[model samples]
Target: MEVREIALGAGESYELRLTGRGARGYVWTWQVTGNADAVSVSEAAPPPAQTLPGAPLERAYVVRGRSPGGRARIRFAQIRPPYPQEAPYDEFVLEVEVTAATGGP
Candidate 1:
């Protein structure tokens, strides 16, 4: 299963966990193209270790909502590396909606 959409508060952060096969040198790397002012993205740590070949690994994508009323779109690609012209093995997209933080009345 994969995440299609998500919601967050201003200044709040969310961790997106993505799973893929990593034993064969194919790694999932993310790129955030939209809503730069309202959000920030980073890779938290290395993916989990797999016990056997062709096993799946979980990668953490750390996304923080910087402001309200904007959307952050992230794309994850399974790259085999050393070949720029070749297409990725897999791709996934995650959309984030940043809402205003509620305050005391």
Candidate 2:
């Protein structure tokens, strides 16, 4: 597993890119831990064309800061479904800190 830290302002968001072997049934999944209310995560819309077999698949997840002055952790894993008991092939952890938005209109 890999860990990374990031900072975001309230209502601000960041994009995380993940690459996996989707062609082989491996998909990326995530969960929010700690201050879950402080952040929200969603997957971006897929591209128009279909992914080719045996090719790497790319996915983008948008992590938005929903509340200020809090921290959250997003855990990600790449695994094949129908084998929930099995271990993940890859994992990543994102530590996020949300702060008050800066500047004025």
The candidate maximizing lDDT is 2
Worst 10 residues of 2 by lDDT: 45-54
Candidate 2 local lDDT, residue 49: 72
lDDT of 2 by residue, 6-33 (tens): 9999989999988887878888999999
- For model 2, the superposed segments whose C-alpha errors exceed 4 Å read none
Model 1 misplaced stretches (Cα beyond 4 Å)? 1-3, 48-50
Q: Quickly count the clashes in candidate 1.
A: 0
lDDT scores for all predictions? Answer: 0.80, 0.91
For candidate 1, report its TM-score: 0.79
On the 0 to 100 scale, the lDDT of residue 12 in model 1 is 84
Backbone clashes for every candidate come to 0, 0
Model 2 per-residue lDDT at 105: 88
Candidate 1, residues 4-88: lDDT per residue as tens digits?
8888898788887777667777777777767867788888887545467677787888888887998878888888887767788
